[model samples]
Target: MKNVTIYTGPLCNFCDAAKRLLARNNVEYKEINIATVDGAMDEMITKANGKRTIPQIFFDDNHIGGYDDVRALEKENKLLELLK
Candidate 1:
């Protein structure tokens, strides 16, 4: 199984949407709330290669961008392959 990590902030609609999408696909993920954790934003930026955005997702260390990227993967029928 792929190890999925989501860097998020509280009250972020995109984050919530991303979580829901993952849940619907039965993909388990770790959620890191950057808003409440010090240094979390920096970590996310580093992982994302300087994309300062909420809902930075990593699948087994593979950067997956944000919610839109996730949805695009799903739309293209590539999400399940990555999840595996």
Candidate 2:
């Protein structure tokens, strides 16, 4: 499986939902909490191409976007392919 990363923040329902989706798919991920981690917010913004949002997801170094984006990919049955 490819490495997964998620840039998230506290009290974010979207982040929780995104995590749940990953869990359901049996995908392990590294969670970076911007609210508590120093410089995480700036890092997430840079990696997310200026999209300052919680649950910014990535597969390896490829940006997979936010929760809605990943959910859409799942719906299209493309997420697993990307993981591989």
Q: Largest TM-score belongs to which candidate? A: 2
Taking all chains together, each candidate's TM-score versus the true structure is 0.96, 0.97
lDDT of 2 by residue, 15-79 (tens): 99999999999999999999999999999899989999788999999998999999999999998
Q: lDDT of all the models against the reference?
A: 0.95, 0.95
Clashing pairs in 2: none
TM-score of 2: 0.97
Question: Tens digits of per-residue lDDT for model 1 on 1-84?
Answer: 899999999889999999999999999999999988899999999989999999999998999999999999999999999787
lDDT (Cα, 0-100) at 63 in candidate 1: 98
